[model samples]
Target: MKTLKEQFDILSDGAVDLLPQEDFIRKLERSIATGTPLRAKLGLDPSRPDIHIGHAVVLNKLRQFQDLGHTVVLIIGDFTAMIGDPTGKSKTRPALTLDETRENGKTYVEQAAKILDMSRTEVVYNSQWLDSMSFREVITLSAKYTVAQLLERDDFTKRYRSGEPISVHEFLYPLSQAYDSVAVRSDVELGGTDQKFNLLVGREIMKAYGQEPQCILTMPILEGTDGVEKMSKSLDNYIALTDSAKDMFGKTMSIPDSLIARYYRYACFAGGEDVARMESELAAGTLHPRTAKVQVSGSLVDRYHGEGAGKEALDEFERVFVKKDIPDVIEETVLDGTSLDIVTILTTTSMAQSKSEARRLIQQGGVSIDGTKITDPAALIDLQAPVILRVGKLRFLRISGR
Candidate 1:
C-alpha cells in the first residue's frame, strides 16, 4: 500500500478541485491502513451517446483510483437521463424516452470501456434503486434539501434571474444524483469541474443520510481540437473514443501548438517525468513544436488503438503534411457534379465539420481547390474530373462526381 502522501501526490495531478482536501487524504490513509479499497462513484447521464477525448480526462482520474486498488462504481444514470441534467443549460433540456435513454446508456458503457477496466469496474444502472423508490420516498428525499439550497447552483440561479422558465423536475436531477451516493455508499466521487455543484451535494446528502460523506474530486475540462472551447461532441470539436487510429491522430495533430502541453496533461497518459521534459523542451525552444505535437498525437492514438498505430500515423502525417504528398488512401465521397458550393464541398469531403467552419477556413486561405487557394467560400465548381481539395496543413481529399 502506498503511503497516504504518495497516493495523494499521484491522485492530485491534473485535478482542478478536491473538496476539503484533508478529508481525501484521511480517506486515503484509512483505505491504505485497512487494505480496503475505497468505492469511487462516477455518474453518467446517457443523453449523449458518444464520448470524446475530453470525457477521458475524468475517466483517466478514475483509472488512477483503480490503480490504487480502489473500486470504481460506474453508475449509468438511465433514470436520470429521462430528466436530463439542466447544468449549464440556459433552457430546459429535452427529456429522453426510456428506450432512447436505455440505448444511449448501453453505448455509454461500451465507449467508457476503452478507458475503464470493465473487469474490475462495477457497472450499475441507477434505475435499479431509483426506479424502485415510492413517491413518498422521493418526497422524503426532496424534503432533505430546501429550495433556497437548490437555488445555490449557479446555473439554476442564473436561469431564475434571467427569467428563463426553469422546470420544476430539473430540481430532482441533482437530488437524484445525490441519492446515488447514498445508495452506493461511495467513499470518493469524481467528476469534471462543471459537476462540482452536483458532487458537493452528494457529500451533504450522504452526511444527512447517516453515511460518511464522500470526498469529491473534480478534473479540469479538456479543450477540444479548436484549442478554444471545452471539448464537446455538440461543438463538433471532439475526438470521439470510437474514432479510427488515423482519424484520432489527424484530429489530435490539428490542435494549436499552444495546447500540446495541455493535451499532454489532460488527454494523454504520458508519464509525469516525461511530460515535464517535453514541456521543458518546448518552453526553452529546444524541441520544435511540430515535432512535439507529432509525438503527442501519435502517443494518444497508440494509447487508445494499439502500440504501433502511433508510428504509422506519424509516418502518414509526415507524408501528407510535411512532404505535401497525397495519401494513398483518401476517403472518396462521390457526389453529383451539377453544381456545388466550395463550402459545401469542403464539408462533403470531411475537410470541415460545418459550413461555417468551411467558410472560416476558406476566408483564412486555409482551403485550396486543385492546388489553388480558394478565397471565396461561395465559389461554385463543377467536379467533372477528380479534384484535389486541401484544408489547412493537414487534410487532403480527392472529390469525384458524375
Candidate 2:
C-alpha cells in the first residue's frame, strides 16, 4: 500500500482544487492505517450521448484513485439528469426523458470503461434511491438546504438578477446530486471545476445526514482544438473518444502550439514529473512544439485505439497531410449518372448535409475535384473517370460513374 503522502501526490496531481486539503489528507491517512480502501465517487449526468477528451480529464483522475487501490463509485445520474444541471447555463436547459438519459448513460459507462477498470468499479444509478423517495421524504430532504443558499450558486444568482426563468425543479439538481454521495457513502468525490458547487453540496448534505463528509476534488476543464472555448460537441470543437485513430491524430495536430503543454498535462498519460520536464524543455526550445504535439497526439490515439494504432495513424497522417499524397484507402462512392453538378455530388456522397452547405463549401474553396479547386457550385463533374474529391482539410471521397 502507498503511504498517505504518496497517495495524495498521485491523486492530487492534475486536480484544480482539493477542498479542505487537510481533511483529504486526514481521510487518506485513516484509510491507509485501517487497511480499508476509500470510496471515490464521480457522478456523470449523461446529458449527451458522446464522451469526449474533455470528459476524460476527470475520468483520468478517477483512474488514478483506482490505481491507488480505492473503490471507484461511478454514479449514473439517471434521475437528476431529468432536472438538468444549471451550472454555467444562462437559462434552464431542456429536460431529457428517462429513456434518453438511460440510453446515454449506457454509452457513458462503455466509454468510461476505456479509462476505468469496469470489473472492479462499482457502477450505480441514482434513480435507485431518488425514484424510491416519497414526496414527504423529498420535502424533508429539501428542508436541509435553504433557497437563499441555493441562489448563492453563480448561475442561479446571475439568472435571478437578470430576470431569466429559473424553474423550481432546477433547484433539485444540486440537492439530488448531493444525495448521490449520501446514497453511496462516498469518502471522496471527483468533479470538474464547474461542478464545485454541486460537489460541495454533497459534502454539506452528508454532514446534515450525520455521515462523514466526502472530500471534493475538481479537475480543470480541457480546451478544445480551437484552444479558446471549453471542449464541447455542440461547438464542434471536441475530440470524441469514438473518433477513428486517424481523425483523432489529425484533430490533435490541429490544436495551437500553446495548448500542447495543457493537453499533455490533462489529456495525455504523462505523469506530473514528466509533464513538468516536457514543459521545461519546451520553454528552453530544446523540444520543438510540432515534435511534442506529434508525441502527444500519438499518445492519445494509442490510448483510445489499440497498441500500434498510433504509429499507423502517424504514418497515414504524414503520407496524406505532410506529403500531399492521397490516402491509400479512400472511401469509394459509385454514382448512377455519368455527369453531375458539384453540389449534387457533395450531397449525394453525404459529404455535405445540404445543397446550401455544399454551395458554401464550394464558395469558400473547400471543395476540390482531381486536386483542382471547384469555386463554382454549378460546375459539372465528368464522373466517367474516377475523381478524387477532397473536402476541407481531412475528408476524402472517391467518386466514379456506374
Candidate 3:
C-alpha cells in the first residue's frame, strides 16, 4: 500500500508544492503508523453564497485527505464573514449582518457537499468559540502577534503605502484565522497560494499553544473562466458549482484555449498520464483547441450534473454556437403596438446595454440580428415577427414582432 503522503501526491497530480514535503511526509507516516489520523482544517468565510470551481480546488484536496483516513475539519467563519476577510481585498469589505451570515451559511453547506464529504467531515462554525471569548481573552490572543508583523501582509502594506483606508478590523481577521488552528489543534491546514501568509500564521499560533505546529499546504489558484484573474463571482468570471449543466458547459467552453491544460490539472481529476496525452495531442497538432475545450467542458459538466446532461449541453453548444443554430429555449417578449426602436428592443431584452453601446458593438461585428451580423446604427425593426438577436459569443435574446 502506498503511504498517505504518496497517495495525496498521486491524487493531487503533483501540483501542490508543500513548503517542506519531506518533513510533512515523515510526520504523516508517523501519524498514520501510530493510527492517529492527522487533523486537517480548511476555513471559508461564507460572505458569498456562490461557490465556484476555484473553491472546489481546495475542497477536492481536503477530500483526498479525508479519503486517506485523516480528519477534515471545515471551519465556517461565520464570525469572520461578518467582519469580512481581508485576504485579497484592496478596500475593506463592507460588513455583513448576523442574520445575513446565518442565512447564507445554511445554503453554503449544500453547495459545499458537492465537493466535500459532509458525512465524514467535521463541520464547525468559528462563532461558537469566538463569540464566547471575553475582551481580555481576545486581547491576550491578539498579543500573540505584533502590529509590525500584521502590517507585513501585502494587502495591508499596500493600503498603508498607497493611503487607502485599511480598517483596524482587517488586522484581526488573520489573527482570528490563526487562532482557529490553535482552537482545533489542527495538524495540517490547506489554502490557496494567495492565502499562504494567513496559513503560516496558524503554525505560529499552534506552536504558541504548546501543540505541534500544523503543516501548511497551499494549492495554486484556479484561474477564472476569463483565463486571467482568480475565479471570483464578483468579477462575473466564475462557473458556480450550482450553475446548470448547460450554463456550466457553455462557460467552460468560453474559457480561452490557453487555460485548458491548467484547468485540467487543477479543476478536474485528470492524472499525469491523461494530461500528458492531451498535451502530446496538442503538441502534435492532432487535436484542435476547440475540440479539446469541448472535451474539457463535457467532462466538467458530467462531473457536476451527470453524463446525460453533459452530452445534451455539448450538443447544445455545437448547435447554438458552432453551427449558429437557434437555441432550444428563447425568451418571448410580446410587443403591444407600443412603438419600440431596435436599440430599445436590444437593450431591454439585454441584447445590448444602451443604444450608443449597441451601435458601437454592431460596428465592431459583435452584434447580430436573426443570425445575421448587423452593422447599421439606424437599423429599424418591424415587430411583426420573431427575430433572434445575438451579442458576442454567449448572449442571445429573442424579440417577437407585433
Candidate 4:
C-alpha cells in the first residue's frame, strides 16, 4: 500500500478541489493504518452514449485511486439520468426513457473500461436502489434537504430568479445522487467542478443518514479543441472515445498550442513531472509544439486503440497532412454520370448532410477536389478519373465514373 502522502499526491494530481482536505487526509491515514482500501465513488449519468477525453479527467483520477490499492465504486445513474443533471444548463433538458438511459449506460461502462478496471470496479446502477424506493420513502428522503437549499444551486437560482420553470422532479436529482454515496458507503466521491453542489450534498445527505460523510473531489472541466468552450459533442469540439485512431490523432493535433500542456495532464494522464518538463521545454523553445502534440495525440490513440495504433496513426497523419498526400486507403465512390455538381457530389458521397451544408462547405473553401479548392457550389466536375474529394481537414473520398 502506498503511504498516505503518496496516495494523496497521486489522487490529487489534477483535481480542482479536495474539499475538507483534513478529512480526506484523515481518511487516507485511517485506511493506511487499518490496511483497508478506501471506497472512491464516481457517479456517471449516461445522458450521452459517447464518452470523450474531457470525461476521462475524473476517470483518470479514479484509476489512480485504483492503482494505489483502493476500491472504486462506479455508480451508473440510470435513474437520475432520466431527470437529467441541470448543471451548466440554461434550460430544462428533456428527460430520456428508462430504456434509452440503460442502453447508454451499457455503452458508458464499456467505454469506461478503457480507463477503469471493470472486473475489480464495483459497477452499480442507481436504479437498483432508487427504483425500489416507495413514495413514502422518497418523501422521507426529500425531507432531508430543503427546497431553499436546492434553490441555492447556481442553475436553480438562475432559473428561479429569472422566472424560468424549474421542474419539481429536477430537485430530486441531487438527493438521489447523494443517496448513491450512502448506499455504497463511499469514502470519497469525485465529480467535475460544475458538480460541486451535487457532491457536497452527498456529504450532507450521508451525514443525515448517520454515516460518515464522503469527501468530495472536483476536477476541472477540460476545454475542447477550440480551447474556449467545454469539451462537448453538441459543440462538435469533443473527441469521442470511440473516434477512429486517425480521427483522434488528427483532432488532437488541431488543438491550440495553449492547450497542449493541459491535454497532456488531463487527457493523456501524464505524470506531473513529465508534463512540467514538457511545459518548461516548450516555454524555453527547446521543444517544438507539433512534436509535443504528436506525442500527446499518439498517446491518446494508443490508449484507446491498443498498442502500436498510435504509431500507425502518426505514420498515416504524416503521409496525409505533412506530405500533402491523400490517405492510401480512401473510400471510393463510383457514380454513373460523367459529371456531377459539387453540392451533389458532396451530399451523394455522404461528406455533407444536406445541399445547403455542401454549399456552405464549398463557399467556406472547405471542399477541395484534387488539391484544388471548389469555391463555387454549382461547379461541375468530370469524374473521368479518380479524384480525391477532401472536406474540411480530415474527411476524404475518392470519386470515379462507373
Top candidate when judged by TM-score against the true structure: 2
Alpha-carbon runs more than 4 Å astray in model 4: 332-350, 353-359, 376-387, 399-402
| lDDT (CA) per prediction | 0.88, 0.92, 0.82, 0.92
How many clashing pairs does model 3 include? Answer: 4
Count residue pairs with overlapping backbones in model 2: 0
Model 2, 39-101: lDDT tens digits are: 999999998999999999999888888898999999999889899999999998998998999
TM-score of each: 0.85, 0.92, 0.84, 0.91
Local accuracy of candidate 4 as per-residue lDDT tens digits, 151-175: 8998999998999998888888899
Candidate 2 pairs with clashing backbones: none
TM-score of 4: 0.91
lDDT, candidate 2, at 393: 81
Candidate order by decreasing lDDT: 4, 2, 1, 3
The C-alpha stretches of model 1 lying farther than 4 A from their native spots are: 331-402
Q: Rank the candidates by TM-score, best first.
A: 2, 4, 1, 3
lDDT of 3 by residue, 3-57 (tens): 7757656534544557556657777778767988878899988998878899888
Better of 1 and 2 by lDDT: 2
